[model samples]
Target chain A: MKARVTVTLKNGVLDPQGKAIEGSLGSLGFEGVEGIRQGKVFDLELADRSEAQAKADIEAMCEQLLANTVIENYSIELL
Target chain B: MKARVTVTLKNGVLDPQGKAIEGSLGSLGFEGVEGIRQGKVFDLELADRSEAQAKADIEAMCEQLLANTVIENYSIELL
Candidate 1:
């Protein structure tokens, strides 16, 4: 099974990286961009496993290493 | 309008960050992890615009700022 994990900053967290990108876009003359938030994506190739098992494992991974949890949120998708 | 841009490293490009993540997972006792690749996601809010226009603008942003087109691929989703 293949899995994806998307990690995003929690609401109200300061995002300097996103701000930088927004500034750069504005400088480059790409107008109409009101706001931007940046996040992380992890694409995984896992050994063949049951869907349930894969999800469970990925959840654990997110909880343990993939996300800070205190300031970040993560979503998992299985394919 | 809202848009999402996902930028991923092109195939055959080395990802030291992903390698480090894989090593960390193994050390943390996450088994069945065959491989890992890391990418980026940008969540963008745009001034009200047609879908086609939003996509076009975002594509230009990607080509010029969001992505290093020589070694990365980007996809845009409008919401």
Candidate 2:
């Protein structure tokens, strides 16, 4: 199975990297850009497993390593 | 309008960071993990525009600033 995980900063959390990207976009003349938030995407290939098992495993992976749960939120999708 | 852009490394490209993550997963006792690739996601808000215009503007942004076309591939999604 293939899985994708996206980790994003939680609401009320500050994102310095996103701010930097917004500033750069302004400098680059992308005038319409109002705000930008950045996040991470991880694509993982795993040994074949049932959909339910894959999802469970991926959730564990996020909780353990893929995300810092206190400040970030992570979503896992199985494909 | 809201837009989401994902930047991913092209296939066949080396990804040492991903390899490191995979090794760490094994250390974490997640033996099913076979391979992993890391990518980036950007969530942006823009001034109201027609969908066509928004799409065009985002395409330009990707080509000019969001992606390194030589080794990365980017996909833009309007929401």
Most DockQ-accurate candidate: 1
Q: Give candidate 2 regions above 4 Å deviation.
A: none
Q: After superposition on all CA atoms, how large is the RMSD of candidate 1?
A: 0.7
Instruction: Name the regions of candidate 1 deviating beyond 4 angstroms.
Output: none
How well does candidate 2 match the true structure in TM-score terms? 0.97
lDDT of 1: 0.94
Candidate lDDT (C-alpha), each: 0.94, 0.92
Q: Please give me the DockQ of candidate 1 compared with the native complex.
A: 0.94
Question: What residue pairs clash in candidate 1, if any at all?
Answer: none
